[model samples]
Target: MVFISLLGLFLLSLTQAAAGSQLFDQSEVFALLGDDVTLPCRVPSIRSCSSVNWNMVEEFQSITEVVKAGAVTAPGGKALRLDLLKDCSLAITHLELHDARLYSCDIGTLNSSVSLQILEVTESSNPGVDTIELHCFLNTYRGYAPCNNKGIRIKWRSGDSKPINGDRFKVVNPSECFSKLIITKKLTDHHRKWKCQVTQDDTVKATTSYTTTIKGGIEEVFAAVGESVSLSCWATSSLGGKGGGKWAVGERTLTHDMSPHNGPFHVSEDSSLVISKVSALHAGDYTCSDSTDQQRGVNKVRLHTLDVTSEREPEGDNVTLACVLTCTKECGKDITLTWSGDSRNSWQSRSMKVNNLLTNSLFLPVLSMASDEYTCFVHRDSDVMASKKWHTANPLQTPAWVVLPLVLLICITGFYLYNKRKHPKDAEHEQSSVVMTPLYEVIQDVNNEDLQHQRQHKRGTTTTTDDFYDLLQAVN
Candidate 1:
């Protein structure tokens, strides 16, 4: 039993050795026009192989006939030769567009023949630009067969001719069946009919091409001081694709922020910079660009500051103060209008319709009859352009009471002075006359006369008594 087992093991080893000797393995193939391409072929088996040969087979042709043989040519018109003992690989130099074909490595003995596909090779061209160096690339991740090797070669050709000799073009392999082409110092002459070709073992050649052209820069659409202006930039061709654009004043990027603005500053969807009030500060070169893709459409815009004349109603007037915003283009919703000074003092605002270049007015009612300094400020939102303060004349009317008090006091004082100056002597004379006409003997009486009259009357009334009274009176 042991002897039988030993014999069976020996036979199994022999069979494994035979299978290994006839085995072959290879890597993917890639090449450029007028460049050398190596076709990888390896023997992993332990058996001693008799010979190894490489064959080229065109896709459009049959591979049945055998032809010339030499160090440079094989029996079937193959473009490469291989040494069996030392090297089982094939080197094809000066490749061409038509050289894109399948190649196979065949190992043979006196009785057996085994073949392995070595890979196809092809040529490619690089893309060019006028004043820039553009690197051209071709990616081939989606190809037949799983390519474990990721290396390729690149070359450059002009107008269906052989490739030029230089290191201006390079090919690199980043992954299995993936490669890229890089070209240095691309010229305008090299922009025509550039192609990229990809090749791998057991797969067909793939080629892609691109055309080159010049790109343009950005331009200013509209720019004015103290006006709501729209700045626009567009690519020369509509086919250039869509990109993001921005408006800038000096180094600051202008955007739409609806917060309360002391001055005018705002923006719109079309990148219209609406400076609510245009001032000298707003007088700078404004730039607009599509920063996302620098594809030479409207890349940059220049804004020029212009002199804007602003006007408004004078102060203390029951007039409407209008802030006019001027612009070359139609004003959009980006513009904000506001009035400063007295109009703002009242905090009363009116929504003014945006006309071509003019705005509506802020009405001031019951204006005071005094010189009023009114200023109308115009802006987009934050950008103030011009502020105009004007003076209005008002009539002066004096009050009656202001002079009445002084006139009354003057009349009273004048009367008192006249009486003193003219009646002083007369007042003294009246006093003297009153003193002379006064009181001294206006009261003396005639008592004796009255007594004699009474005595006579009594004697007549009665004889005796009267005679007695009479005698007595006579004696007295």
Candidate 2:
């Protein structure tokens, strides 16, 4: 009997894993205003899925049939099964705000896949930043419940010192396991999610949550090399050090001293990251969290930094310069780009931007030879966004050209030193050959028998990279 029970438990575990292996694995699915999204559902047993049904986990946790066997089962519902045999996924078309709810797909197994849907707040275009709303949700042992429970406390305060309580923040319970807290006020704080925490046994634990977004905030910033940049995650200074915060980029988190940020970055007591000198490495997404949120694990932070880059190429006698700004859709508007350094007066110019791609490109053709240096400037209205400097150079006078000469010099010096080690007297004229015009090309034509002897002694039949260049050209 014990053996049979152990086998049943093992099988149940396998079924649970198999059920969660499909799609986002019950992760929250965020929808926009008008998204035709799919609340994917995959059954554990494909063979039993011919009659398997998709159901909405309603207010009382009751199952309302949605679709069955690749067909809609509910009347007036736009839900459809992706496939019966290959997939048990459900597709939701014309998604609405209320559609963000819990769902499950059962295929006659001990375990089934479940997911919760939520709508992401749309970015408001309203001026004055006067109107702001905070949407808060709650969850408890009894599933999602109201936010006004005796032991329940909604922690949705922002970095702004102003307290949000009473009628300003209204808590409404439309259904079980769901509560919406609506607040109307002028907010200058960064967009953040409401933290739903429950206090029990003199200890607090976080529960179900709803995210909020801020409008008309600067989400992207571009900085020039050597320029100072201040990235504010949230104005936590007003919290009176009652809480600490953490900053992170990708998987790496920040500590007391900056390691990955080699460009001299400092964290102010106010929880703002101040980069004194920006470099190419400083460009990427930055996220921060109030240390108080570590318990809740609600990571709500945003910042985009892109360092400027310049490219130049041969164009007859002059050079064609391309100044590119790598941006993203998160970058806000009021972008004004300018150019300088080439003219006696600072030159103002416009950059062509593509919406889908956050790329901004400004091209300057046939810049006069008299120009010593060139620079590109970006601004959001009067505030300087970023600046990149480009020094004017003649064709074949670029950094690549500089590197070519240095590499050739190193090769020649090594060859000359090898010759000097053995044939001390022959090294006399080697110095003169090094000073010859077009020195790199001159080494190829040099008929120095001593150098040739050294080459023969070191390696037989020199291997040249020039032939591989032609091979690459052929492939191109």
Candidate 3:
């Protein structure tokens, strides 16, 4: 049914042309929407025209002549005029929906017919999505009209003028039926809408809108210490199969074998970042993107390095301990490295001038005391990001006098053991003889006292006997 309707429309147009006094067929003119177009009627002889009349028909309704003898008389004739010398044609400016009807020029026994144009605007944009071009297109039509199509007459606009074109816009090609308009300015803003209106016969036949949007992705990420995290990204399916992915922190490129980072971060084939261990160094802004296609697919995720570390020197007068604040990537600025401990009152910090320096650390000096604890905290302003602890050993000391007895005792024991081992029998004999000499002296003294006492008693008894004898003799 659709094919028959189109065929009937074609035949009816031909039959109507035969009604004119002349039978000249003129090709249809192509024009972009909101542009100017000229419909031509010519004679083979190129003679002066007695009179050329331009007439139009609406759908199937016949209309009066829009122009006659090179004079403008149409509703849109202000911008229209006739060029009637070798050829007599009607020109219309700023064509509209009303201009889409069949236009015919009538001459003495000679007539020419042409239909206005239609165009389909192709949408195009640059790689950055910055510049966009809307160009009109049309299929081939017989220079004269037997078939009519819609696409050519379109008006492009946004909140601006209809059929917009200016310094910010460039119209490389403009026609009553077909045109190409480029937006040269940068379109970085979001959710911008453009419109295209198709018109014919002074009425709007179709209106459409072309909208451009700025896509958004993940802006930041929070990764905890010791917890695995992935910086999410999306690579266009258009990427080549051989394409590889990488990550970036500041100026440093993250690699699978970044040994300095303990090989904790690696990027997948899809450009996603997976950190097996989130360390202080690994906490920072990371860009998950493919190395090949840099612009089309790119994203950044900030990793807050939450891990902390500490180191302490051996016990001494001024024990030095350190709290390290670092990450896989250089955290931009505004970081606070703090020191705190049980010996806080007596301890001294290295220097607070270490602010914003790439090397972030807090050195704490503690007086050598038993079990002194020190804590270091990292902060961005008042928010503490990480902290660590360190303990110092007590001072070790001993006096020479206190050690003398121990040294002498050890020497005596060593000398005796050496003599006994070398001459075991001689050492045992000397030890017994020295012990028995005191016992023998005690026995000799006891015998001498008994002998003295016996002698005294004997002398006394003799004296007594002598006395008795003397006394007896005297008595006789």
Candidate 4:
């Protein structure tokens, strides 16, 4: 009886295990044109007795057994045999655009389905010039739906090398069903074999290539620091594929082998180098090359160094050392004054209005004999382009006593002249009157009066007018 009970218990365990080893949901399907894609199928549980099968359902009432596990009904019936049910996934090789459709997977009594969609991508009809604009479109395919309502990856190649993104090239999405790749700047490298690759779900499925001749050489390149830059390495002729471009620092190579994407350095399509922060270490000679392409071209860029120092002075007895700027245009509007010294110290600034010829002065008041350095920076207001340390002049100190003597003399002279003019009538009156009389005339008149008085006394106190007149005439 114990043996019988143990066998029954083992049978019950097997049944429970079988029930747990079943697939719960459908698998995901992916398809791409001109490329192979995988159809994923996963079983939630694993059981020894469970079986899985993959079949292709096509046409009405027609089911073909493509893969089978656990059981087989007919031999040599074009059915794929699966020795292990765990690896029951389907792989479609070299899938065409028409291969996009629903697929089925069945396990024991459970069944699930998946759908896939394919998109076609073609090469650009016009590969575009470095300076000219280019537009790329999708290619046409048979037995496939319109290449609409799906996102496609667009990439390019120049000659045998891979294409990269830069300021000159951009992708534009005009509508839900279409996108355009535009090349803003044209270069001679754009004339080589150009290709467009379409990718769906990280897999490149189709590619189209075109050949176009590019004109002109590289002119100017502008790039930012710390960002990746790509340089176009194309040629003018079809045989110029071997004659591409390269990047260099002085004589050093900065091509793909020396620096990959996100490597120590990078370049743009117009041969612009992107150095992050652009420190002194990044300062060096940079050159773009196309020796391999046989065109043998090079471009150079120089990195500049910048250093700044600021100072502040007290209001009194402070000397300001300012930088004078020579402006080609109006300096007043383009110039700015700033003081950067003590963190807590505030800066004083004044701006002059711009004119046909700009002249700006940064004024600093110095009350005493304190020497303080001041900096004046001039910049173009429109571009914020500043001049180098063009003018470094010391502030001059002026004393108030220098003008004091002249001011006092002017005040004294003005007061004296004002008083003389206000009393003009009194001056005239003083000039007209004589203060001193002749002494002889005064003595003669006194003597005559005395003699007349004596005579009158002598004549008993009576004197006639003729006697007074005679006395006056005798005195005269």
Candidate 5:
């Protein structure tokens, strides 16, 4: 009887080894964190076994059954996460780091096993800068332990299939299990998604993606009151072109497919948000997000109205020019008021801020009546945000209406004087011609009378020489 029992035990050990060998290189499986994963079991006896069981091999070779008799038996919702499929494989949903372990499926005396490793991706960025770094690595044991990376490779790509390797995007391989993707922000970087892939022996094993969110890095958009403005998405001309996107302002939300008109806002065909007539109410944070509800970009729009007025200083003949800039409380801080053009001493102006309103004043002494175009600049740090031009004619300066008549009178007087001097010689010649004509006529008459007298003398009528001489004197 003892000999028979030994032989039976030997046969049982042989059968268990045969069943485990049926797994056929089912050694490891990779799954992305927070995703659903399945460990396959294809033993030939799976369908004919009297009972199917799924177990997790814990540390120190301890065995914990998760599924028994083709049903989940783990505690609480953990049991719900673990399910036995029709083929006796084990399925896990909403996978957690703690789920990474050696998983096994047992069919009576037959068994198969696989090791689970989690692929996780994370991102980091500096404040006030548009650069970000993404890290992808294999992890296990609740992210405290590194998984073996023999023959494993990691890579990064943009969107779905665009490989990322250029000046703006750089990939660094610190290890076989670790990868880093550095991105310098651009317009196209907004609303973009990057994917990390884990491959072993040239076969893709796991993938995960990270989406960039615009937080402290805001794109400032400035517009004047009553002017139309378009708030485009950070990257694309059309918002949500990849999947779908939406525009948000405070508590209000709008989708890409919405009607063209929503109050003062209009959604164009290209999916840009247009403000028909920008007003104080439109100044605030505008956010664009993808269909997955991930924030892609932010627009901090500043809407303001600028006006300038002048008055005589109470103490002197100097004029006080005050520039007023008005906006809503939603306008962010860091605004400075500066004046350009006109007097160099205008740099000595004074500025004050009350809530969202700012005033800059310059004092110009009464010297000469002059017209100057003074511009008020709204400054944020070294960058100029907006500017408004005000044409100031010193109250001491001649009015435009008064100057017009003076200019016309001066022009007429100049023309009259020029014409009078241009024809002096012609006027003298005309006067001389009028005065000398009668003298010439008298001389001609005398010559005619003399000729008549000469003819008479030649006809033999004796006319004395004294008579002829007296006639000549009378004619002269």
Candidate 6:
């Protein structure tokens, strides 16, 4: 039925053109809402004539003269938005929804018609429900005939050009002219950036972006110590001139120079503050301002670092895994640390003040069979703000001091046993040799004394044979 009506309109238009003596041409122009566009008068007979006139169909089928005699004749405030062109064309700037209309350009012996349509985005958010609703649609003049949208579609996409589809995203297309996107908000979606695109035959005809504000209060940006961090400034407006502005920590303004001599803090091209190898000293309140407008306090962000360290207990057989969280601002009571691992064993974290740092320590058994992966989670109530995963030992690997002594003891015992087993025969042989040495020495002495006696007897003195017999009895 809709197609029959459209065909009827096309036939009626042809009939009207045939009845009119002037040559008639018709075209449809698509434009983005809030942008500028020109409606061309393609009639070849058109000349640089002051008699060229542009008129639009108003509500109640009234004709309103927008441009007359090469001049903008639009009423009141609309006159500022309309312009006349040399080729009898009509130019509109800063277009609004009401500007979409069926326009007629009349020149000498020729008439050109243009139907203007605009694509726009509108949003409504419910803070209580934590949801945002976006509507992308085609806008035309009220009471005017519906503009042609045969091959046009409105779609929602993420910043990375991926179509948004998940449990948190609900999409509804109520009509061919518009689409609605509903998003459930999450803490991780603080940026809340989305894009709406109008495509015709798979080609993008118009596009717009919607980003929620992170302003109105001080927010936190988490970073680990010794890691690079970038704190983004709220880009309220397009930046111009030297830079977005200055970034300051506490009262000291950060340097913007990109040279190597510049300190760790540098201002990025997008006006974010980039810190290289951020440390505890970098934890503080940071503020970004606009340079061109002299607007101060454009954004305020609190920098916090979650640092993890492990130490062996001095007096116990346990390892202390400490999560030290440093906040440039006051730490909320909801902030907490949770230790998680693959093992079923659960360790409780104890909060303590050590060396002017707030540390949460988890004491695990020295011989824990937990897996190599352990995570330290920084949580605010039920939400995980940040987490750090580290590799730890299972059976908590024995220290070198404990292992070295055991190895040394085993080596020494092996050496002693080997020597004792290998030389048993040699020890027995040595004992028998010691027993024979005394007997052999006594015999030698006895023989020597007898020889001396013999010599004396031969010289006319009798030698004592009983002394030799005494020596032999002693040897036995």
Give the worst 10-residue stretch by lDDT in candidate 1.
436-445
For model 5, how does the per-residue alpha-carbon lDDT over 1-476 read when each residue is reduced to its tens digit? 11222232334335457765333324578987778888887556455323877767555445677888877888767887877777777889998876767666667656666677788888754422667777887763222234344678888866544466456667777677777788776542443467889899999888888877654445556565556778765533343454244677665676544422344766555556787775545566666554444544444333355566778767766877787767645333455778877556533578878777788997777553244777777764334556767676545456887688778877875764465468543332332222234654564455456656666767744678888788889999
Top-TM-score candidate index:
6
Candidate 2, residues 169-286: lDDT per residue as tens digits?
5554454224354555422233434444333333443333344455434245566656788776563435546326577766788776773456688777777777787665666666
Q: What's the lDDT for all of these models?
A: 0.43, 0.50, 0.54, 0.43, 0.63, 0.68
lDDT tens digits, residues 1-476, model 1?
Answer: 11222233344335435756332343334344455565555544424333544444433333421122213344444434323333545555565554444444444421121212222222343344423333332322322334433344333333233343334445554444434444443222222344544444434354444444333332322334445655444423334333245556656766555311234665544544556655434444455555554554444444333332323356633555555555434444544555555545544446555434556465555453233565555543223434555454333334566678779877875774476468644432332212211231121112234445666776667668777788889999
Stretches of model 1 off by over 4 angstroms after superposition: 1-23, 45-50, 64-72, 75-86, 109-476
Question: In model 6, how large is the Cα lDDT of residue 398?
Answer: 53
Q: How many collisions per candidate?
A: 33, 3, 32, 27, 2, 0
Clashing pairs for model 2 are 144-177, 145-177, 244-291
TM-score of each model, in listed order: 0.23, 0.32, 0.29, 0.31, 0.42, 0.48
Judged by whole-model lDDT over C-alpha atoms, candidate 6 comes out at 0.68
Better of 1 and 6 by lDDT: 6
- Candidate 4 local accuracy as lDDT? 0.43
The best-first sequence of candidates by TM-score reads 6, 5, 2, 4, 3, 1
lDDT of 6 at 111: 71
Candidate 4 lDDT by residue in tens digits, 179-266: 4556554332333345556565666655656554444343222222333333343322334343344566656676654542234654
Q: What is the lDDT of residue 182 in candidate 2?
A: 59
**Candidate 3 per-residue C-alpha lDDT over 1-476 given as tens digits, one digit per residue, 9 for 90 to 100:** 11222443355456555764645675556556576666777545545555766766644454656667656556645434333334566666676644566666766667667766544455654432456676544432212233234333546665333455345566543444444557643322123455656566556655545554445533434444566777666543445453266567777876677722564666665656777876655655566566667676655565554433445566623544544444434443445566664545555566333332233344445443434565556654223445555555443324666678789977875775577568744532432222234543553354345556666757767677778688679988
RMSD of each: 36.6, 23.4, 34.4, 29.7, 23.8, 20.3
TM-score of 3: 0.29
For model 6, residues 1-476, the per-residue Cα lDDT tens digits are 11222343354356446756363776667788689999988767655748887877654445688888788889989999888876667889998877877777776556777777777677764433777677777663222234355776778887655677557778877655677778765433455467878787888877777765533556667777777888887743464554575677777766655412243766767777788877766777777778666654467777778888888878768777888888765666556777778654656568875443567887777666356877777765334666776677543265876688789877875764466468643432332222234644664455456656766757643446887677679999
**Candidate 3 displacement at residue 280 in angstroms:** 8.3
Candidate 1: Cα lDDT at 117: 21
